[model samples]
Target: MPVIAVLVLDGVPGHQLTAPGLAFGTAARHHPPVAYDVRICTAPGFEATGGLASFRVETPWGLDGLADLDDTDTVLLPGHERFRDPPPPDVVAALRAAAARGCRIGAVGTGTFTLAATGLLDGRRAATSRRNTAELARLHPRIDVDPEGSVVADGPFHSAAGVLGGIDLCLDLITLDHGMAVAIETERQLFLQLHDPTTPATTCAAYTPPGSSLAPTTTWMEANLRHPLTLDDIAAHAGLGARHLTRRFHAETGLTPLQYLLRARIQRAQWLLERTEDPVERIAALTGLGTPANLRRHFQRQTGTTPTTYRTAFRTFVTNLTPRE
Candidate 1:
């Protein structure tokens, strides 16, 4: 069994910490028994800091209570908002010690900042959220950071971009150490769709913060994925002109209207494939991807697997074991 230590820093992004906890924690609940032993470790005397919401939280054990590097096989770091500021020397030292002891170090989103601060990322290829790319490069010139891809592993150091990408990275890690089938099953159990690194910015850029002006439009796109929507139609729904809609969509969500629509359709296709035993053509029609050939082409381009292969390999292994009745 691999004991995994998740280092949650002060002022960490609440969602970042919770993302891995949900993915890996759910994975640890597998029926055949999971190989991971995960724990959340905070810095000594660490009081919960304000994150996404106005709330305070406290964990049971602090840093001292964390399993030593000698005992653990993997150490995970979730992102913190304070990436420019240096971590405490003791915190950096502990991580370095873990890395030196050959424990795999994993960082999600801006947590790579902490790793870079410790010099662990020197000469290493890693990844961080696309929005943080320029600053990350400026702060740590030695590390090779890929803003496009989801996960990158340099030696034993693994990293991922975005909150969702962390799930993909963890699954990839488990798959590499375990097996493909186990990873696929984990994804099934978690209801996680494997992110397509090849899709460029459609899904990633389509994401918008809540309360943003474009959120309503994004929601509308999501709801209408199965419908053939033109840019004029989308603009009309949002009560805006095509040009204004395009600009606003780009500014708020970092994606154009068409890209967002395609991603929504692709995401829907993925869900239908995973959850239903419907034929590929039916899934395609439901997701607005049209014919089975079109569905297979797009699905394969995004997921590196054909629709039939993905459904056969993933849908069968998931529990909850209900046939389409």
Candidate 2:
């Protein structure tokens, strides 16, 4: 069991307070007793957002609760009203001590400000709410602030952009703790619970929507995943130089054209593996990976399992869905 301490100040962000419990709880229940020790530890300072402000907040834990954490544990900081101000000396020391004990530190939205003040984020890439990105950069010059990403994880520290991004971070942590299958189910359950039945659930792909300059190019890549694509080919299709294409593609999708193409190919392979009776060799060629060995290598690298294993798990998942639910 992994222990997670959600350290909330007065104005705790709703996402920080809820997402961990939701994501981890779903994992715990769906996986048959992978107990998670999640607790809300209250401390002084901060203001509440959303409907939480209307009521008095109370929790049995405090900052002292973080003392028991080890490397496998996580300490989460939620954005509060006073997050913009520097963290108090005791708070900073406590965070530092937790880090020294190998506990991972995570922050959501403005909570990153408190993490940054502790100097733990120095020389690390971090992310925060888009609206506050520039200020985060200016205040913590040593921290490399990424405005484009919804979440950034460097070493043992992780930071997310907003409420939704915080949930994504938690899902990522679940994946790290268990595996991709558990994480995907957790994500699917969350989507099912949060969205209307009429809405379709989306996959966890590095998918980019339209409106970017690279939209047409991405669409073309998806349609032509069977072809072995090169940088020059993608650049020509986009009517740009290779250098310009890489820069623009990365700006829009946070991935190079080739990287995006490979992921798209793998995603296609996943769909084929789940829905069709295609052999590994056939699926490999269909996805432009050329050989079964090649497909297995990249598939394992991205998904943490072989193609056969993934298909087996998917089958088991479908079979067990009714009883588990």
Top-TM-score candidate index = 2
Poorly placed runs, candidate 2 (over 4 Å): 46-53, 194-325
Cα-based lDDT for every prediction: 0.71, 0.77
lDDT of 1 by residue, 1-325 (tens): 6777878777776665666666677666652345566777887534564455734556665665344656348888887657677888888888888888888888888888888999989998889887887788888889888967468988989998854537778887777765443465566556533463322211221345445787677777777777788999999989999999999888765678887787667767766776777888788888788888988787777656777776665544443232121
Predicted candidate 2 versus true structure: per-residue lDDT over 225-288, tens digit per residue: 7888899999999999999999988887778988888888887887787779999999999999
Against the true structure, what is each candidate's TM-score? 0.59, 0.61
User: Model 1, stretches more than 4 Å misplaced?
Assistant: 192-325
Compared with the true structure, model 1 gives a TM-score of 0.59
| Error of model 1, residue 219, in angstroms | 41
Question: In angstroms, what RMSD does candidate 2 have relative to the true structure?
Answer: 15.2
